[model samples]
Target: MGPPKPSITISQQAFDEMVKENIDDLGMDPTEALQDAIETLTLQGVDLSGIVTCKEDPVIQSLDRLKQLNSNWTDRIGKDGDEVMDLLDKLTELCSAEGSGNAAIGTRNGGIELVCSVCSKLRGGSDQGLVSGLKTLASLLHDVQSGDTFQRSGGPKMVMAILSDISQSSNILNGGFSVVAAAATGNEIVKESFMELKIDELMLQILRTHGEGSIHSLYDAIRILLTPDDNRVVASQVYGYARRFAKTGIAEVLVESLKEGLSSPSLVSATVTLKAVAVNDEICRSIAESGGVDAVLRCIDDSGEQGNQTVARVCCSLLSKLAGSDTNKSAIVQKGGMDRLIKLAARFSDDPSVLQEVMSIISILSLRSPDNAARAIEAGAGDLAIQAMQSFPGAHQMQRNACLMIRNLVARSPENRTLLLHNEIWGLMTTTNRIFTMFKQSTFFQELLI
Candidate 1:
């Protein structure tokens, strides 16, 4: 009804302290002090809308506010876009708070339909309002129950319409894709509904049109669509989706994004999305043939140079996944993949997680390939493995990964076995063996060492 208040948070202790100050410093009764505190904070422009209180349900109150705004939409349609945006922002904040149950409550109270209506009304009128509405819808859909409600309510169609109408605005597309991704997570029926809607085609069109704009959430949505759910009975659908993505040229577009000098977040998102789509050997080879291996290697090198361990670690993981194809393994080795990995290992030597990922790539590369094994040893793989084993003795996974890398390095090359043993690997192997033996339940460890 008036100017929207600025949304702010106060700690429970701070709020209590303020109430106590009113009681002690002003000699006010407890009820009077609490009321005075609320009035003072409200007059100072701090929005206490969703603040937890013993007397009222904040979730219901927030929903009522949204309903009020929606009921009065006609009167404020063109005159109060800012107020609409502010309400949507507050709703988004409430729904996003972890463990608040606000999303579940909102979902039960017809929140999806309310927000979708707002989105439709804001279409072609207020971009910011529409974006905020979409974001709030996404937050509400994070709950699985909310997702099912969204699916039955034809929310996906509304989202697709909004995305199509606003394909030119990166902000709107991001928010829209966020909703799509949230709706599709762990919900196979909703995923199928989206697939029937030809969500992939629409997504590819957006990627092609806005590829340079770097919509990170768009890549995330693509990954979620192609990923399988917990229901293993329908897990085979993921492979089909992977092939569809590759055939539709999604793989090539992702490879191109990897080659671009994207920021760290964008680079990680693109790499992760490509990794998700490469579900089979053929798609892995397809990515490699499209220069995916070279692009990933460059990213590893660049991220390592900048000391960005997260990007370097993710790039290495993607490269490892791509190297599941024998051809890509060879391509990676020839394009200096092993060299880049060794350098990455050296740069992030203190980080066992990155070291473990590098070791994993080496292990994959050397699996049954004596020449690649020989090349890895030459590129200092043995020394790297030994150093990792020594430095992080308590790092169980890294130790296991190092053992696997050692096993692969020597499995086919007798000379490598002798070389690694002579480099005092026997002691490190015994140490790792002892570490695993202490666990006493790791049959996989015995398999690796043997």
Candidate 2:
């Protein structure tokens, strides 16, 4: 625009050397040396347009750029839109760098307020900007301080507004849900804030409106809301949240979503959310009555056919949790859950983690029910457990879970003890006697042997 802005260029190495010279020769503070370098280059008519000035840490630099861009935001999308998106990208990268302490740095630099302001400004104007802002905000809120700031600054309300806007794109809604999930994780006050905003109701409405398209992030947020805090004192609040979610009809909606054919990611998230929501025996029974058991078994069958071990593993875990209820245990058996689980174990025989989940389910199902125990044995759970034990001799959890499943299978059913004994469990036990020594001192292993 003005005589081509007097263009000139320098290599990155050259720029670094210049900054080094300013610090080494001039004996200036690093920040002062950087500023001096920038000033000298600008006065010399050198274009340092694409250079990283190193004036501040990356988190602070990004926040400052975001603040500048927000001030210049206009109705018409142009260069400012591109700059806004770039800043968001840089902030997201900085905050997510593992062990960099950038998230904590960001919180100290008022990143929460700046990013939230950017999101609020970008609302309804730039979908790309709004999406990126939400993503950056999520990363910034990884720690407790950022989450606390977000809650105090009415972040939940802003995020809920973004999600409630029907005119927003699916990408925007997904990003907003991710922010909710991140903010609610391990932070009691933020969780309470989101609860007061009726985030659960909003989540159910979004699921109903968007169906499978938004299931992954929405269910992730739902799961975080229902999960207990790490502190044992607030653990009871999780049960309260679960009850609230159940009363909100989320259990029925979740079961319905499972009935619909979901992709692997969506199915995994749905099962995880269901697991978190089934916090008490009463809620577990409610979900079971809502056909949650059959729905989950169907998910296992579908995921197994697709060779998606992750979905199968999560579904098995949910089935195990639901089986805590006596009624759900029978329901799982009635729905052929044991057969499905045993087949899943066989299909994923190479994965000890999957086998552990399967064995855990069997342990619960056979806890006090001889029929279920017999069904488990009849469906080849004993064979599956023995095979898992033999294959994964070094897997402590797999071995422990197998031992528990065997104990439960025989605890109430004498016929199962005879059947399992004849199934060569004793031979397998002898083969694993050395490995079982790791647990020999434990009473559970002693019971398994007897």
Candidate 3:
């Protein structure tokens, strides 16, 4: 049956171990961990169909307590609130499922009743139940909201908890199609909920995953996050999540925009996403090896400083970050970032204000690693940076920056300072002086001597 549940199925013994891991991690009771693992694995369609079908497993056995406990919840909230919450904590810690992209849940009327009860009149004294009850309540709310009217709760904690449910596969509570449809219907409310939890990656996962029905709001959230007027304060939240959990579909969306050529400031989402995926070695190696590299490099060749300075900063940062590593670095250098930066500098060569930005990026990448700056020199970045000292017009911020970057190389090894000499590191001292009134003791100026 069911094509013989994958041989990798979690056996009873293994499930018990996970339960031992306590609610925090490896500390969960093995029995509980096993249950959580199974639930998560089950939702992801991990090979536990056999165990699920066995119908006699300990997890299913443990769930029997839930039915009995449901009736006791009213009493538990009154008499044993803390104990109940402890049980719920164990349940969430052990049974937590990750978002399965397609989170299938339903709107059972009884579940609705439970939803209403969280806000119902309080009991006498401290609620008898343990904090575990809150976890169970949260799980119920997340599942119910996935397909019920509780989708628009006014409370902030309630919303964060629902989004936090992503740590557990959204599949844990996929009861029926009605749940999915209901969730789709209240898309906007779900997005509004995220505005509060935007800084939480798990919450971002929920928004990006289940929040798809209200994708426009998701996009708008990004817009507000990166809006020029207020970007400095919260821009990191949007960029941070996009990098951490951008949807698979985004690649196609961005490629289309990049090909459309400056139609949409592709960097805001696309570049940020590429850099995000490029972070961890596992994700980076995969994308770095694929055609994704070419797409990102081309994005740089196409876009300008139109929307989201941070996005642009991340793009430059990605190229710079990948500098030392052979796999991604080679790809960046080969893709013409060096030459591209040269052209960017030349285009704004006469405009000091614009060149200030170009030079600042140069300073960042220069410090990324000596070899990257070396590559910049080989690509003629050295000359551009030097000439930029003059046309930069404002403070010799460029020269000062270059001198400081050269210092890092100097501190680690005198050879790094020697390497900068080839970039004509010494010649910029006068320019560095203009940029820094204190010339000799100034940050970059000191870098020049070393």
Model 2, 1-450: lDDT tens per residue? 333443687765788799999889989988888888889888988866335555556777777877776677666543248878888888898778887767766776678888888788888676787888999999888766578899888899999888877556788888998998899887878888888888878777777777754546888788887777545243446678888888888888887767774453366677788888888899899887787887888888877778888887888888889989888878788788888888888888999988899999999988888888889988998888877887888887888788878888887777777777887776776567654565457664445445
Question: Which model scores highest in TM-score?
Answer: 1
TM-score of each: 0.82, 0.81, 0.41
**lDDT tens digits, residue span 128-190, model 3:** 232233333344444324423554434334434433444333332222112222332324343
Residue 106 displacement in candidate 3 (angstroms) = 36
Residue-wise lDDT of candidate 1 within 144-262, one digit each (tens)? Answer: 56778888888888888887753548998998999999998877777778877888788888888876345778877888887777352435476777777788888888888788844
| Order of candidate numbers by TM-score, starting with the best | 1, 2, 3
lDDT, model 3, position 266: 39
Clashing pairs in 1: none
Regions of model 1 farther than 4 Å from truth: 1-55, 69-79, 231-236, 262-265, 433-435, 438-450
RMSD of each: 9.0, 10.1, 18.8
> Where is model 3 more than 4 Å wrong at Cα?
1-217, 220-269, 272-292, 303-326, 351-371, 393-400, 404-427, 430-450
Q: What residue pairs are clashing in model 2?
A: none
Model 2 quality (TM-score): 0.81
